[model samples]
Target: MLKEFRDFIAKGNVLDMAIGVVMASAFTSIVNSMVSDIIMPFVEAALGSTDFTSIVVKVAGITFRIGNFMQAVFTFLIISIVLFFVMKAVASLKNRFTHEEEEEEEEVDPTEALLTEIRDLLREEKQSASK
Candidate 1:
């Protein structure tokens, strides 16, 4: 059981997933900061300095914070768009590196060639003997 656990932990996919989780967490923080600190200020400026997070509505004793919800929705949209472009750029870079214009030369396997030669020789011997 211990060996199995160790093998599972040592797998490449598990390590990659762990790294991805860490990177995504850091990316989330950067996106959150970009939305709240930079973008929201500009939006606020354009909207006459209205505090979107403070706008709320109360109905039948239930308080609804529509402004905060809108802010969150905008933040999510920005983050998703940023991530989409980032992923697209990364995919393009990866393709650029992995794609080659020059044609790759195909090499025949020596063992397979030898096996075919042996089979041909045996067939020739059998046909000659039959004749």
Candidate 2:
């Protein structure tokens, strides 16, 4: 059981997943910074200093931070678009690497073809004799 566990942990897929998780976490920070620090400022300037993060509403007893929700939505959209393009590029690269041009079928060996013809001719002769 210990050896099996060790083998599982040692697999390339597990290591790759770990690395991916770490890189994704780092990438998330970069994306978040880009959205909050860069994009939001430009957006705020265009919208006359409107802070979407602070926009909220209260109804009955519940407080709804709609601005934060909008920010989150924008963040998701940016991330999704970036990921979509990245995946598209990776897919194209994978297709390029894995694509195999079809090759014309090789001619059958003469001896094999002759034997097949002879077998067919014998079968035909047998069928005729039986008839």
Q: Which candidate is the best by TM-score?
A: 1
Report the lDDT of model 1 for residue 21.
Answer: 99
Model 1: per-residue Cα lDDT over 6-114, one tens digit each: 9999999999999999998988888778767877777778877635688899999999999999777776777788778878999998887666422232455789899
Question: Global CA lDDT of candidate 1, please?
Answer: 0.82
What's the CA error at residue 52 for candidate 2, in Å? 2.1
Local distance difference test scores for all models: 0.82, 0.81
Clashes of each: 0, 0
How far does residue 96 in candidate 2 sit from its true spot (Å)?
8.6
**What does candidate 2's lDDT look like per residue over 6-83, in tens digits?**
999999999999999999899888777866786667767887764568988999999999999987787688667766
Error of 1 at 86 (Å): 1.8
**In model 1, where do residues sit more than 4 Å from their true spots?**
49-51, 100-131
Which residue pairs clash within candidate 2? none
TM-score of 1: 0.62
Cα lDDT over the full model 2: 0.81
